[model samples]
Target: MPASADADLTTEFERLSLPLADPFTIARGTTETAENVLVQVSDGSHEGIGAAAPSTYYGETPATVEAVLPDLLEVVEEVGDPHVRQRIDRELRERVGANPAARAAVDTALADLAAKRLDVPLYRQWGLDPAAAPTSSFSIGLAEPDETRRWAERAVDEGYSILKVKLGAGRTAERLAAVREGAPEATVRVDANAAWTPAEAVAKTETLSGHGVEFVEQPVPADDIAGLRRVRDQGAVPVAADESVERATDVPSIADAVDIVVAKLQKCGSLRETRRVAEIAQARGCEAMIGCMVASNATIAASAHLAPLFDYADLDGSLLLDADPFEGVPMSDGEIDLAAVDRSGTGAVEVDE
Candidate 1:
């Protein structure tokens, strides 16, 4: 691929749905419908796909994400030269402003296109070693104890060895106990989505810790950095920063408070920015987890490329979708089969017309 081809990149967007059996809820609340933002980049014959989902936590809706697409595309079109990819990557962070999920659609699509042009797998492009990829934790949304147990049992039956449960609606203890009983052999964890106060988080963590729960995610508010540190100090269970640590700059302040940093592609703007955040977390001796925003196969593929670079991964958003557009990355037995992506870029298959 010649550097000149970089200047010819173009983008497009589409919307898709999720396949979850029931509504999924976290500390940010619940959603019955799953809407995703798909980004497609084309340079003559070869094309690449990327995906993202609007995050209500960032005040983003499908319409808002779509509205930002044109401007993001314009930025990608104007930048030229070999560094065009890197330049477009930087411009996205600057002009795109906030809304990582929106920017992620653009950045990931462009990266996919570039990778296809170079004929290389996205992970190889990022200098990641596939053998080092981390195991991803499959998620279990909130529900009645019996229902939650059923879901956990299904996940384990599906061959998933690690599970992350959504807590904080009510009956926290009972809900967790049900998951344990359901998936007795699997490693279990929970995320409260910042639903508790520091004291409440500590109390909840202490209670859940007795059940062999691995760790808790964002128990308190994101802005409560000090509160998070306190929770971390008080519990035997480690506290991971999800919403609190979005940008790379936030790393230093909460370095001592979090044992793990969850980097959501949508929350961090683009894959380039997401990688930077991961680098920062690693420097601080904190483990990195690459998460998604309830996206589709396109976006999930982009995230999967970064999975090998982190300690934890939760890229099951595509699997939850009712109809994912692209193919390539396969989610089975609690792991994403990335063998197809060995070639380059997103390694995503074309969306059916």
Candidate 2:
């Protein structure tokens, strides 16, 4: 109940309501702002920082994460070394219950602090080869057919070779065709965000095949496993599960139904758990796609540490923000340049005030 005299550390957090470049719409709803909380763990000189951005779909809000993090900070301050991440993480997961976003913030901050103490980047600390990091896909949110084409072209102009287009809006086929027309050479993945019925998903997947779409994500509702299986069986394009696989246990239940399993740090809580979920997906013969909620660079940088473990990377959460107060991983030409981030921890640093 009391920290030892040898354990002297400081922990702090702040709320952030970051604005998006545009109103981001999905099958669920639209968001013009990202509600997040930033966490920092320090032992005198060395410090590590991370952020938690809650997603409404995950049943978390900024208020909930903020309320839970204070108690979490108290528990983590007693930790002598943040490198024993599993022990702290397991305790937090147990204490925090279903609050994955809060757990992610603390887990990443401790990890960052530990890596910084060792003077090595998080990738190296985790024994992950930096070169193995995958290229990330730029997201094009839902819009009219012409606007969709414009967004696709904008992403291409910004040196993004892969585009993840948001579907489920009207004119799905035409919009996808427009996306292809805009960035004909770029890899295209579509996310319906669980907007369609099994039959509609099958038909849309068939139509999207003509547009050179690579995969369709969460085509059916999260609860509709049979529907998902029907889409996977009857559809031509590969299917990825987003809303369905929040936890590792959710993976096996839908592994046989989908071709890909999407994992997010916010939903998985800890980086360790997110990695485990990805591993589970790969072991089940499903492609592992590391995804992100609309968050700041701190969150994205934390997720980038595990980028090598995934088949696909969607670490563009910070890119959607209108302004970022921190610098984490660097993205150049749609790829995470790990060399630039080879300094310490997650390589996330606050902008000089």
Candidate 3:
């Protein structure tokens, strides 16, 4: 019998400092370590795991995630049923309201618990098609032109057919030239992380089009709806909204302005809301990308299960790590292999020392 049939849930969390393989820099800044809080839920037998990779860029830090987790866990305990996910989602929102990352940890953990109780993977629980999941893109952080060239070449040599290169702080032309010189055949995408003005974004997009880039993400400031509209209308390449589209509600306002909406569980607060954002984006005729923070496999696996519902994926957070304490779904040549995941739940197994 499944544990959800007679649920007795216990919740706990721990902070982990996951080191990066290289100093990961974006348009905003650089990060040598990713601070994630791992949350686990148990039903006396199997354990379900998830994590919160807090980003100061989104007004969350390790301290903030840790501070709010007790209340979030209290809600999980009070509910006492891992299967009652919608109720937990509602109450967690009513309770914490601000800490999206903290709530996401609990939500993902509970989802994993519920799915494991039934001995099914999360994508199976959601009734999603594994065949539909798009190939994920490996990200290359900002660096000098020579360094960018080397990493791009290395990623291609490592069998990543797709590469997401971070670009900003000027020298855009030289950096992109470096990438093209490195991996001319690899599918390339760029994310500026909201570092440009509308005019600057347009010019950059023109340059991106020249490079045969797939798309440019968050080119202008997040709040600049008018700027986004201008870029989408005037830019040479398609634009995707990552920083601007914070949740499902933000979808309607920006859907018409951009070609794609980027959804991240860390930003949305729950697995359910992430789906909502994708559904709403599709309904609005905008493509959706399942993106992630530089996080552990505990949470990346959770996001990977949702790839079947998206047009693109950027769940390469764990690949950026020096070492992850957990292992999740398998990826080969950037293909997310949810079908290859034999373990139930999110497939987030802890790595043994």
Candidate 4:
């Protein structure tokens, strides 16, 4: 388990299709299934696992991730050192700048492997305190007002106190009202997924404020920084930047325009970049939220390991699955219990089907 600059490593990957517990709909689209690519790296003794849940919104699909993973894994093997994660991440970025999810799979696998070598959980490897991690929020994908109410009620019954309700244009107010009616005491947040114009966003925030909405995420389109600023300047509720902020460098540019920067591991390319995004968001006087796509624990676990650095977390990706192929971090009542991760590495391992 000792570190080696000239270590020998092997890598491989396979496709992972996960069925959603319910058809997940957002403003952009609906998903009954999630396509992911699982990446594995080994040093003959220990194997590290990770998966990429590619999103078309980010311009990457399972096909794209599968196509680029070989090249990305080649970078990992070429580096020949699991501990030199920065170098592997750098080369992966230099090799393929577009497929952040693909690069993320490789980087996560390597991090898991390296952490295994050190015999410590990833958060411990990063010198983070488990208790500092914020509670994660459960998501309620866009559905009918009655159905949305049922989802909220179910979530509350399952011990989730925080809810992230996805909203589109039609019947949004009714849906949120149902959520409130169902779980009146639960903390509520809404994500428009950039489905609205600036004016529409402002109006929605006014309406959402009445429903006790904590904030609105990606109210306007990704390219509309001015629209974001307009909403922030005029809306009753504060705004969060999800599509608007992709990486660390992006945070500074959009920081003045929004109240929160949402960082996802796959979107940011690697764990390091996601951390950088968090740091920059904090430094820029914006709150940081760690989020993830509808993914398995393979990648979500690694993302959760960085939760101590963020002000908010929406890492219920695996929780939304009908079942997950891999197991990683465990969430209880929405709190990502990093302290419970006794296994070395990220605690992400494929379970028997």
Candidate 5:
């Protein structure tokens, strides 16, 4: 084992249930309960914590994520060296197959423990600063036009400058118009969650363009590469890919179609993998946006560490929760206080005992 490896460190996993104020609906599925997996690593002194949420987009349910906990813990216990850890991380993902969300939970915990061991924050490991946290957009799930508009207004009033509206149940135009009317000065973006056909996507983009919408996310299905390219070519607004760009392997194939790539730790399977996706997206001339599933402060705090490396962000998952477990990353008028976690590791304050 390498000198930096902590062979004595112990790992444990837990499941938590958090509630969402309203049902969160996207193309993949609906979420009313925030199903989270937390990883704790102890060296008999300081402890490091990391989190993840099971996402339906990746075929993950709470039960599935929970069921895989024992295997993930075994991998953590067996791996020690950082390089070996990284390789083990990859192998574990393959071993577990398509459970990216579960893989992410373990990977993030390992990274957090490594950083904490060195007394360095996770962002610094990725060449980011804790004092300068990233800004992120809050999401507005599918709702009636009036309700959506009111929600947008409330978000703006609460100091959120960017708003991501969930569309794709056939009211794209109405919703966009309502948002525009309610928060004219805010940066508004729409995500269709792959709910539209190519033709409908183009038509909806045309209708939404006049509202000064920032961009449209995954307007077409993830499998339709040609459709995404067509939407990009015809639409005045930029097209971003959420569901389409899942892994580093998928980056090259869809590079031309997407203007932005949303990187979620759950989708990419780890902080290392998520960083690789960001680098790949940037190299391919596509902007990167770090996002999260409906998660709590622990995962959101982890995502915030990577926010500065991206051009756009949608990481305010904690804000959507009815109650968050930990003290959340501080935000002031739409910007994260990067200085909060200037220490090593995730900078997560201890959840109340």
Candidate 6:
């Protein structure tokens, strides 16, 4: 039996309304903070940590997560070994209902604990090479032209080579132009957050291509597969599906419509599921991108384990926060320094209060 097998375990969590460095605005709305819940799982000796950021867009909130956590804790308590992470993840999903963020917290915590028991980092435990991971892109949420320009400038000054600019605020052309003006040499990727019609997306893609944009993400609503295909087929830049592809099963259906599929831990429910989505993208001949909700260090660290499998990475969720309760993976010069991750488990440990 594994060392973690049959070990007694306990779970603990806390609600966090983490402030952002600036108000985060997108096609949906504007928010001043990221609402999250942090969870820890322990087996007397080894401790593992995870975090969940609930999005109302996904029908989840801090309250819903808090409401479902007790049942999730009960389910986790029944597990004999944290190493059976996928089995535990499935059980949690069955017990927790439509709470992917909650399930992500539990899954990450258990995966962390399992890696801790083996005294290795989660990526190494998964047999991933940190050096093989691509550099992550810093995000510039929708803002005034000057403000957007400043964000892009700062990102470039900090050595970020790629900029992920949020569009779809009715000034798509102005926003993209402003960002390009701010960091003229930086590679750019625009996310419309499903705000455009197929025709609008196609037109904007041509305009944006001239500004040096590398790609466009979720140009239409999630359910509009035909619209997505229209944009992908007609646009100059490649189209990446974000809201359209949530599960591995959703991959095949949209594979022909997108050049890339964006996978997020909260949306996929577990690292295993996220990997499955990446594999599906690969099998379908589409590039894979790893994305994240506004999250804490624990979540970033956990997601970084799978960074090697992606063609693009937008995992700067923790960097957007006003304060991070933990630190694991180090982001420097536009890349997540996977070499800096030498600690055990998911390598996320809370800062001193």
lDDT of each: 0.78, 0.87, 0.91, 0.91, 0.79, 0.87
**lDDT (Cα, 0-100) at 207 in candidate 5:** 82
For model 5, residues 1-353, the per-residue Cα lDDT tens digits are 01122456677777889998888876556778888887776667667677769876688887888777667666666664333567878678667888888888777667767787788777777777644445678898888899989998999999988999998658777888899888999988899998999888888887878888889999999999999999999987899998998888898888888798888988888887888888999999998888888887777777777877788878878777888887656766668776665656777765686
Task: For candidate 3, report its TM-score.
Answer: 0.97
In model 4, which runs have C-alpha deviations exceeding 4 angstroms?
A: 1-7
- Candidate 4 local lDDT, 87-202, one digit each (tens): 88888888888899988888899999999999999999999999999999999999999999999999999999999999998787899899999999999999999999999999
Steric clashes per prediction: 13, 0, 0, 0, 9, 0
Q: List per-candidate RMSD values in Å.
A: 3.2, 2.3, 2.9, 2.8, 3.4, 3.1
Q: For residue 16, what is the lDDT in candidate 6? A: 81
lDDT of 3 by residue, 6-115 (tens): 24777788889889998999988899999999898887988888899888878998999888888888888888889998998999999888889989998899989899
Most lDDT-accurate candidate: 3
Inter-residue clash pairs, candidate 4: none
lDDT of 1 by residue, 81-169 (tens): 22366777678767768867778787777787778778888877778777677777888887889999999999898888999999875
Candidate 6 at residue 27, lDDT? Answer: 92
**Cα lDDT, model 5, residue 230:** 91
Q: In candidate 5, which residue pairs clash?
A: 120-344, 120-345, 121-344, 121-345, 130-338, 131-338, 131-339, 132-338, 133-338
lDDT of 4: 0.91
Candidate 1 vs 6: which has more lDDT: 6
Q: After superposition, how far is residue 262 of candidate 4 from its true place, in Å?
A: 0.2
- Distance from true location, Cα of 25 in model 1, Å: 1.9
Residue 295 in candidate 3 has what lDDT? 92
